[model samples]
Target: MQLPESQVAVLEAASADEATSIDALAEATDLPPETVTGAAFELEEEGLVEVSERVDETIELTDEGHEYATDGLPEVALYEAALEAGADEEPVSMGQVIGQSGLEGDAVDIALSNYARKGYGSIDSGEITADPDAEPTADAEANALEALADGAVGTDDDLEEVIDQLERRGLLEVVETTTRDVALTDEGVTELMGGIETTETVGAVTPDLLTSGEWETVEFADYNVEADAEDVESGTVHVLRQMSERVKDVLVGMGFQEMDGPHVDADFWINDCLFMPQDHPARTHWDRFAMEEPSHIDELPDQLVADVERVHREGLGEDSEGYHSPWDEEFARALALRGHTTSLSTRYLSGEEIGEIEPPARFFSVEKAYRNDTLDATHLLEFYQIEGWVMAEDLSVRDLMGTFEEFYAQFGIEDIQFKPHYNPYTEPSFELFGTHPTTGELIEIGNSGIFREEMLEPLGVDCDVMAWGLALERLAMLTTGAEDIRDLHGTLADLEFLRNAEVTY
Candidate 1:
């Protein structure tokens, strides 16, 4: 029978025979409606009271509706003037009728249009005629406006229909609010009959209460042990960002250092450094986002550009003939949003960033990339890329497969299927695929290959280097059971999914 003061006040104010709204209880107890609602919920949980909700829509008048109710509708005023000008007996000049109506500007037009539509009068050849049978006092819209102003619109369908019409005319607004009701249970009635007592307990120890020595005498409210709390979304990290951080932690634990670079960069680091040919179809406007303003990068290493151009125009050494199509420094210098974070790998491996690295080096980057992709369940205009590279001596495809196996195993994805693929930069590349748990369909997640000499020789990396570009969103989708990449991000993101999403194996 013991409870907080708020719960006791709510129980006393609530009725056993009928339900009382939370607002009514708050008013009786001199407490906030939100406080009363919370106390009511707690009391309901204890089986001493019941809390229920119903949605109620309230119709109210706007300023224009109030004005029309007091000053009379413009059409009504015009019709009254038309009668006074003797238009009901015969035709009167429209100018003289309008002058008698005392309506001006937009109101004059409103009166003329509605006057004819409501069968009140007619205007023909600069002459107006009013109907003798027309009664302006019986105007439905005007009566509805007055009813709303007086707060007396009952369940009459004709009045409600007029209310709808008035709403469409922008003269009022309808508000839908959730109204909660509280009612006493059998236990609450029995407690009341058994002489319920009010406890002078304090919810908090305020400064004034403490200074007044009232804190020592008053009982402080105890905290509720139940799992009840307000849902806080702003404090929760986005599921995509949570996965990004987790990926970084996993990569760092696997002995990889993080890399940093620009979201917008020169095509040199994005493609030319990857040995992607200038004439490649992907480099065209069909795939990449080309920058317009400040289109070209201001600077690039002269000798490195020459080495890359040389590797492209002719064969690297004597075994491998380069693209041999064409090499344009202008195309390489053009700037655009990076289509992949592999540009960071290109920058790191070339020692242009963070100085030269010896063999047995590992680096990775989890960052954003832009692509002009056809949007779908898995595609987005901008997405995150988990770019990584490993540099060591005597590397092969087996090493690449083993690394993938170990990495994917951390996410409980034991079945990683790799398909052989062709890439201009990598001699033997493979695409990584995983079976989606929900759809049971194989989805491509990443791509990997050993760095070809045409790509590495220009960067002065003599040893074998394995590199990969993984879709961060795809990996998140697998871990979080998100069916659409759009659901994980963008304006159409499902708020309920985001609120409850937890990344798991």
Candidate 2:
């Protein structure tokens, strides 16, 4: 039978009576170690040879261990020094022994402790004395070091205890190595008895062969289908970033335009434009992160500011009554890290930089927001929010609910429940919830409602505008079945979860 030269060499080296190691085969075949390993593996796969493995634990000396093997252990040095000082007759000062031993710092303590433990010396009243019958000779630790210095020691029960002691002292390490032994199988014996032929085969097609027109005449090596291939790792997008892209894709597919704004924004757009009062509890120092530099925004439109002030002081028109509280312009102009991406919606609907707002236009933003929050399993100081608004003429609560149903359907979530909620900006507000797949408990995913006239009139939005602000982390947690928010995005993020989480929808 025809065979590659390397494979034929390996099979001939292995014997039916006795198994030879792969290294021994390599030496007999006069082939490189790597070439022999590859050939042996391929031959084993073909049922021509059997490869057996044995793992052996061996001990080897580190730099510190080799030093001790040459100069002797610190404790031994201390014991020898005490004996030379005639400590057996009268106690020698501990400082004098340590100085003579030439050990410093923690090594002094190590030597003293070990010297006493080995019964080589004793310390009392701050004085050191060598044991009366102690003699200078190599101990088990020194013997173990000597053995390791020559070659690795394997499975010697007496030497193992010595090695463990040395390892604990940080002098040596125990390492396990696997040895592979290859033997000829019955099929291999039969093939060799029948006589095998080794032919010269081309290892690779080179540029010279193509140029000389010799490719057609030369014999090409057959590809080894059973051979191990090199590992190739392609780059992949981070799972969290991928999830955000999927959210954008779903929103874009539903005819929504993306929007973005500064993470640090003026309080006007963040709260005032949303009909939130200046003295709202959320505006306190403990709940929000206020910025120092660029302390307050001065470029806000004077007319819109006046309109917001009037709306807060009085009602928008005759239909509603305002908060009737004092409006502070300085508070509206103050800067802070936005607690939600609704600030972007506030800017867009106000038609500030986005030009005139026309009916039937839908806008959404998936961006990071910040809060002065306590961190825990479910809360992060920073997180992503999905804020969206649908502006159309003659819209109703039914339209808002239908938009939510279509949006959530893309995630394979069919069962959704809406509970009546209250927000200053939306009149018919709702807390959107979905059933947890594992626990069957309803978890709130988002909040939504039709915009109140008090909020939109200041922004010059005349039509009905349905708006919602949802937590992107909550959505990701539900989709990925993550029990804790910290496991998804923080210093505590689980590498296994991120690596194994499959992006869905």
Candidate 3:
């Protein structure tokens, strides 16, 4: 059988009668370690050789060990230097002894401490004195370094004790390395005895060869279908980001136009315009993250500002009675990180940028929001909020329920229940819940209601408008089938879950 030069070289070097390591084969064939390994794998796939792997524990010298192997051990060097400096008469200054020994940095401390511990010398008050009768002989550590100087040393009872001491001193390191042994099969022996021939074969077809029609004339190497291959790490969108894009597609498919707004906005657009009173519990310091820089905004239109103030101070039309406590324009302009993306909806509905909102105008935003929430299994300080609103000349509670049914149906969530709820801005509000696919427990998904006139008139949206705000992460949790919210997205998210997660419908 014909083979490439590398494979033939490996076959000739590997023995049929005895197992030979890949390193030994490489040495015999004068090839690189990686080349020898690849050749062995290819030969093994061809049934001409067998490769066996064994994990070997090797003890080798560290940087410190190499230094000690060349120069004497730190303690031995200090003892010799101390002996020369003083003949048991005068104590040598530690600084002078360190300078004479040619050691620096931590080596000086290591030498002095070991020298005293080994009974070779005494260190007292910045001075060192060598023992009078102590002879300069190589310690067990020095002998171990010599044994390992050539390469790795095998562990034995005698050498093990020395290894322990050397390892404790950080002079040696033990590592586990997988070594592959290659042995020729009977077929390989027969082929070698039959005189193996090397051939010039193309391993890969190049574009030039293909274009020139030269590949047909050249002999191609036989493909080893069972050979080991390198691992591939292809680029992929982050799981959370992929879910966000899917959400955007779903919304757009439902005829909702995407909306964008600032992450930091004035309280007027965020809370005040939403009919949240100035002294509402949600606006307190413990609930919201207030920004320090660019402290406030002052560009609100005078008429819109006055309209919102009037809604909060008095009432909107006859059916609406405003908060009736107080409304402060200064408080409205105060800047903070938005607590919800509804701030964007409020802006679009109030500002003329979206133009006159005729019936059936739908706007949605999937954007980030910030809060002062403690991080846990169910809460995160920052997350994406899916905020949306639908406007029509005449709408009812049934319209809101039908919209949610159609929206969640796209995600394969069929069972939904609504419970009567109370919100400051929605007159007849309801909390939306979906039965968890795995847990069988009803989970609160979002809150929705028909916008009260007090909240809508300030935004200049006169028609019936239904608004809802939901957590994007919660939807992602359902899509990815995550048990805990943290497993879907957070600092503590499960990496394995993200790697293997395939977002379901």
Candidate 4:
């Protein structure tokens, strides 16, 4: 790998006295900031220098690492000693062997095991032994035996000899007379360390070490290091989160006070007060996440309950008459995962504080709503909804439509069409649709309308209350070009997918 000269200079200039930032190194070495940083990272991977804080890219090294710069140990010796030390003990774990042997963590585990099999030591379950007489079965033999017991037939004299040797050295002992355990001897440690010394003596360091005159050299090796990759630039926020924030910003900008509510709600506020009958089809298992705990509404206002009963019994002027069924107070009190953020709006409207509020009060909420729906490309079990209410003497359906258009325009969606729709809660309700830029397909984005008198009268909302809401996930999916809802939160480490995603607005 070719490294920039600046990076090479940084490696050479790194000292105990002075540390340099990537910016400073870039200025001194006449390289771009990015280039200097990249070079520093490359040098770091080569084990020549250490980089701390990539934001500043400070270069430093551990004290022992400094010594490695001047007098590097032989790789063979390092491997052998690691194996021997590991084998000499009760089979020290590979991690412990690397730590004790002063070898790099990567490749050392495999190297030590190879050395053990070469008569330097034995490795089993990450433990190493260096005793020559230790009857540590080679990894291959042990694996073969395991495979045989698992219904495979394979045998070799060498494997038998290794087993016998292990038995003779008393390294192999029966545990509960069922399984054999391999133990290492003290001699194994000495042999492993001796192997390192022998290997190092046979050409480990460069000749320049003996007669150096400004000699420049590069060492190349590969090993797995558990280092996090450089952080790459990517757009901020998920599409849903961005949409939610935008909605909140717009509502807050328009003098609307945000309201918070629990995800679990009693059916009373969600349905009964809204004039929805207790036996409404929406209360079925297919429509909601019914909760077992706190399955009762204990503190509904008596006046509101009586008003709701009146509305359900006699259609509050919208229809000639209500269904007139007995209001099932128990059913109305059942707990459920709120199906919409409008539940918060409804709750706020029903409270005494809402009655005391000045005319033209506005409120909004962006929260997760739960539903029991089969997973699909455009559907999710849980999703965010941007719900806002405008309660004023003059709030009209046109105002709601204008708000929808302005909010969607923030996401670069210009064309919006509305179709009349039936909603028990709103008069002149309309389903809003937006054209998908790529597919040119019209998609229903959300629903909006002025609150019906039957729905608002009991809550003391006397003026026209216009509200509009949509799922945030649908917006994000369209904006991010995410074909699957799951892609919004990637499952793998490939940052390129996120980096390459195009954000229109």
CA lDDT of every candidate: 0.87, 0.84, 0.82, 0.62
Model 4 spans > 4 angstroms off: 1-236, 352-355, 489-505
Residue-wise C-alpha lDDT for candidate 4, range 406-501, written one tens digit per residue: 777877877889999977788889998877655667777788888888888888778788887787766765676555454554231124445565
lDDT of 1 by residue, 11-94 (tens): 989999999999999999999999998889888888999889999898877787789988989989989999999999999988
Ranking by lDDT: 1, 2, 3, 4
* Model 2 lDDT per residue over 1-505, tens place: 8888998999888999999988899899999978888888878878999999999876778888898888888888898889878887889987788788888865665676578767887776567888878655757887778768878465669877877677766788778898889999999999999998997788899999999999989898777776658866556676778878988999999999999889999999999999998887778764688999989987899999999888988877787788988789998999999988899999999899678889989999899989755444455778888999999998898999998899888888788899999898899999999877656677888999999999998899889999998878777777778776777866456666787776687
Off by over 4 Å in 1: 1-20, 23-32, 35-49, 53-179, 184-238, 315-324, 354-356, 494-505
| Model 1 quality (TM-score) | 0.62
Better candidate number, 1 or 2, judged by lDDT: 1
> Which window of ten consecutive residues has the lowest lDDT sum in model 2?
372-381
lDDT of model number 1 = 0.87
The whole-model C-alpha lDDT of candidate 2 against the native structure comes to 0.84
- Cα lDDT, model 1, residue 419: 98
Q: Give, for candidate 3, the lowest lDDT window spanning 10 residues.
A: 372-381
Best by TM-score: 1
Error of 1 at 210 (Å): 7.5
